[model samples]
Target: MSEPVTLRVLGTSVTLLESIRQRAEEELGIRLVYEIHNVQQAQRIAVMQPERYDLYDQWFHNVDFVWPAGAIQPIDIRRIALWDEINDLPKRGRLHTSDKLGAGSLPSERLFVQHDGKLGSQPTERISMLPLTHNADSFAYRPERLPDTLAATEESWSWLINEGWCGHIALQSDAAIGALDAALALQAAGLARFENLGNLRLDEIDQLADLLIKKQHHGHFAAFWSDDQEAGRLMLDPAVSIQSLWSPTLMQLHRAGIQYRLAVPKEGYRAWFGGLSLSRRAEGRVKDAAYAYLNWWLSGWPGAVMARQGFYISNPPRARDYLSAAEWDYWYDGKPAREELPGSDGLPLIDSGERREGGSYAQRMGHISVWNSVMDEHNYLVRRWNDFLRARKAA
Candidate 1:
């Protein structure tokens, strides 16, 4: 008997879950070896060691990092079974003409593999990555922890760095994302401004980093988390009244006790699109398995799982078939959940009559203010971010 083909899948906790692996292995009759890491570490491994993985499931922005290193090969849309079903959001970078089309590395900016062998937006037969699960992200807050004065006001990103919430806030620790979150807060507070919030220049990075370090010195931030689980536990800390959280973390908080309000910040969401890429080294049967996995994501079930966690799949209508009408209405249509909805654990996550915070899919996505990005000065930004992370107090 032949041994099962084993494909090494690398990604963060967001997509590389044990259940998904089990289901895929069962359904596809292939062995999957998953290597889950924090976003930064996963990208580093993907860029520096392409040989380590057959399938790279990560942020679309990561194509900027891996493509330059010749780490990942282009994906042929012809091989993707449902490529045409994928909405314009990823293919063109906006779902509607009115969509904000936020700054930074939008999927459309670098999705296609151009004639010059470069990642560009030009229509091409090949793409750098296969669009996967994506989401609009914002901070979560314990409404009970908020003082009535602030509670009565509109939700805004400023609360993350404002003096009133000082000593009781937390933020994600990824250099690119954390810096943007801080920049959003700083800009909201009227302390800093930028021409493009997504790609901060060196001066802007320094300004944001310095202000974050000073805030750290003053004990404005209670803690920082790099992973979804870490963010979950951080939110449980009494000191952390508000924190940037992903869908998984929000779900984690929901199951632990009360559901944290997924904030509809007046400033808009920090949006991100995740995708799957094939390692340059992948070939033959191994590459076949990789494509099978990518195609599987758009088939229905996997997308439904992601939708249940508050993410929007690349092909929404297919996932809609797998989800109940209640779920589609609650999640995509932005209508109130008509019935209780189960989470990954098959336990109630959403109660009846609870409207999604940002309204429908189009409404939420249209309001994106920025996308997770890798700026041209990424190295310097990373350095400053690390220095800020290591600072015990302001210099």
Candidate 2:
């Protein structure tokens, strides 16, 4: 018998690794070695020592910058026959265009084939990296607690962050710093920005930092969260009442019996995506095995499991087949997937299809208006954001 292909994965959660392991070993005829690491630790290992893992589970939103730094290689997707099966979204598809992608990033609706044998502008190149699942960000709040005036206008992103609701706001942790940019984009559209104070820009951060320093402020944040689990917890508990959150996590919380409402907000929620990538150091059969694993993930049973778990799949078509009509209704609306799925607070989640879309949420904070797409500015913004946080921490 051929030797089993041992695939080591870093920065994946135990649940996710277990799922992958079951699929890879049972289905792929390959041996799997999986390791779980937090995002920070994974980045540190990748930077400090390159060969720690063969495959790294990284978020796609930030993965593009790593390629230029030699941390990872563009995936050779052409080797995987199912490459054509995967769905490529706007920002994600543009990651390999030799052009930096950010807010206003264009979509590659058509498939480009490989060239003579490289991963670049040529259409026929191998795929650089494959993403697994992603979370969509949007505004969420407790419907019961919100004032009738605002709750009545829930269709818009503006109502949740309106001045009347600002004082009760909370933001996500710094890891979810992108939520800050989303807030800025909303403010640019003449909507009210949540005053988390933690996610402010370099100049704007000072005032926020000062307020936080004085108030010793702590509230549920409107920012994106670093820990996937916390999103559910925060939604269940009224820490800040209103903030940006991932769709799946919130849905999971609702299913677990929490009572909360999520909307795109008037300005729309900032969208971020996470996926899988290959370490540049991986070679030989391991790389080939990794490709196999990626392909397997895109097709077959695992993709279904992931979609049902509340995440958006990069392989949309395959994922759709996995979810039932009821699941679609639950995802599309706040309703329970079925009688078995309960809201986070132990009640049934709101099922009004009209309710989710009726508010000013889409008008004020929609995705198109909210993302800061200037790719060139990402470094500057990230650096300033980090520095501002540093100063805040020191103060």
Candidate 3:
């Protein structure tokens, strides 16, 4: 038997592994081994240690960090089975707008490879990554904690830093996302305004960091969660009434019978997209296995499974083939569930008559306020982020 092909993937993607492992082995005649890491750690390994993994599944935001290190090579779109049908999001760019397709970032922003080995928004046979799953994110709040006097007020990202919720809130600990969320909250609260939400200037980062430190000193945060499991635990805590939330964590909370509302913040959602990439070192049979895995992911089964948990597959039309009409209406049309729905884990999550917070995939993604990204001053941002964390610990 051949040695198993190794894949380094984000921790949240364990469900994909569980669902596809056996099928991949059966179809490709190769065993698969997975190594999971948090977003930050995954980037470090992909860029600093490409030889360790044959395939990498990660967010597009990290391409800037990893591509420069030559950890991953461009993917040949011709090799992708459904390349042409992969959605206009990755073709024209997420921010692209036309009479036919609505406004959003051009998918080519990170998809196409440039002559200098960097990524660009130009069409090329070579692509930095194969766009996979994406979604908009917002904070969740306990409805029971709502003060009756403010019952009719619209939920806003401002709630994250609202003095009333001080010491009863949590934030993501990942620097790239955490910083962006904090910046959004600060701007919403009129604390500071950033010129670029995705890439903060040093001064802007310092201002946000200082505000976070001050909030920590005032006992504003219940905790900082690094992953979905921790986020779910924090939501279950009585002290935590509101916090940044991911779709998977929200589903997990619902499965546990916890009642919460995923807020559609007036400012809009923090959107993100992730994809699959081939390692620079992957060659021979291992390289073939890597391609096999990527093809399987886009084959619709895994996409259908991811869709159950609030993620949108890059190729929606393909995934639609595997989903029921009721599932499509509930997940994609923003309609109430026709019946109880099972989550990625096969546990019941949404009850009948429940509606998704954001309307449709197009509506949510089109209005993306900012995409998750690493800023131009990433080193400085990391230092300030660490300082904020230390301040919180001291407090």
TM-score of every candidate relative to the true structure = 0.97, 0.71, 0.93
The digit string of per-residue lDDT tens for model 1 on 40-123 reads 789889999999999899988888899999999999999999999999988899999877789887999999999999887888
Cα lDDT tens digits, model 2, 89-131, are 5324432444333243222211222353323434445344565
Model 2: how far is 2 from its true place, Å?
5.2
List the lowest-lDDT window of 10 residues for candidate 3. Answer: 98-107
lDDT of 2: 0.52
Pick by lDDT: 2 or 3, better one: 3
| TM-score preference between candidates 1 and 2, better one | 1
Q: Quick one: ranking by lDDT, best first?
A: 1, 3, 2
> Residue 181 CA error for candidate 1 (Å)?
0.6
Runs in model 2 deviating more than 4 A are: 1-3, 12-17, 88-124, 154-163, 166-168, 175-224, 328-395
Q: Assess candidate 3 and give its TM-score to the true structure.
A: 0.93
Model 3, global lDDT: 0.79
- The lowest-lDDT stretch of 10 consecutive residues in candidate 1 is 386-395
Q: Could you tell me the lDDT of residue 280 within candidate 1?
A: 100
